[model samples]
Target: MTVLLFGITKDIVGSSTLSLPVSSTSRLRTVGELKDYLSSTYPRLRNLSSLAVAVNNSYAEDSDKIDNFDEIALIPPVSGG
Candidate 1:
């Protein structure tokens, strides 16, 4: 699956996009799983106050389903003056 990064998420991951390989034995099925995977892979992500995930352009809940063909994005909390 490919995940787009935005705001601080982009800086944390060090890239604007992230790709995850999918195979029969290992596939991410839920949004929560994706969050766990990312947090584990990029420990710094766990430090963020909040992280929102969008799948196919809509905000997704932890129970939301995900697939390799879906569009995903990580949106970090944004603050402005």
Candidate 2:
């Protein structure tokens, strides 16, 4: 699956596109899993839960199932304007 990045997530990912070894058929089922994936890929993102997430341009939950080709992004909270 591909996760669109924003804010500091791009820096952590080192690029805009992340072709992870995720199941394209079964999207990310939980935030914990995604966090794990991120941690495995980018060690700096291990504590991803400190941030927020958005699936397909909307706020996502811990149990949300990311669908195929879904646009997922790590909507980290901004500290200031």
Candidate 3:
């Protein structure tokens, strides 16, 4: 799956996008699972106040299933004056 990173999330991940494999070892079947995987792999991501995941341009719930071909994005909290 291709995951787009925005704002602080991009900075933390050190990339604008990430290519994650959907394999038995990765087990990224649900949005919740993705979060867990990210937190464990990229511990820095856990420092964010919140992270919102969008699938197919729509906000995804934790229970949402992530298909291998789905478009995913990690939107961290943003602030601007």
Candidate 4:
């Protein structure tokens, strides 16, 4: 699956997008599992106060299932004047 990073998430990840391999050792079936995998692989992501996952332009819940072809983006907290 390919994940698009935004805001601070992109800076933390050092890339605007990331491609994940779908293997038995690193399976990404649900949003919750993706969070766990990211937290473990990229510790900086855990430091963020708020991180929301958007699937197909809509906010996703932890239980939401994600497929390899789904549009996934990591949206961090944003502020504006």
lDDT rank order: 1, 3, 4, 2
lDDT of each: 0.91, 0.71, 0.89, 0.89
State TM-scores per candidate. 0.92, 0.75, 0.91, 0.91
| Best of the candidates, TM-score | 1
Clash list (residue pairs), candidate 4: none
Candidate 3 displacement at residue 66 in angstroms: 0.6
Model 2 weakest lDDT span, ten residues long: 19-28
Candidate 4's error at 18, in angstroms? Answer: 0.4
Query: Alpha carbon lDDT of residue 48, candidate 2?
Result: 55
Model 4 TM-score?
0.91
Query: Per-residue lDDT for 28-54 in model 1, tens only?
Result: 789999999899899999999999999
Best by lDDT: 1
User: Which lDDT tens digits does candidate 3 get at residues 10-64?
Assistant: 9988999998866732567799998998888899999999999999999999999
> For each predicted model, how many residue pairs clash, with residues at least 3 apart or on different chains?
0, 0, 0, 0
Per-residue alpha-carbon lDDT of candidate 2 for residues 1-81, written as tens digits (9 for 90 to 100): 777777778888888766666453355577657866677768887655576778788887877777556777877657766
Among residues 3 or more apart in sequence or in different chains, the pairs in candidate 1 whose N, CA or C atoms overlap within 3 Å are: none
Q: What overall lDDT, based on C-alpha atoms, would model 2 receive against the true structure?
A: 0.71
Residue 72's C-alpha lDDT in candidate 4? 89
lDDT of 1 at 63: 97
lDDT of 3: 0.89
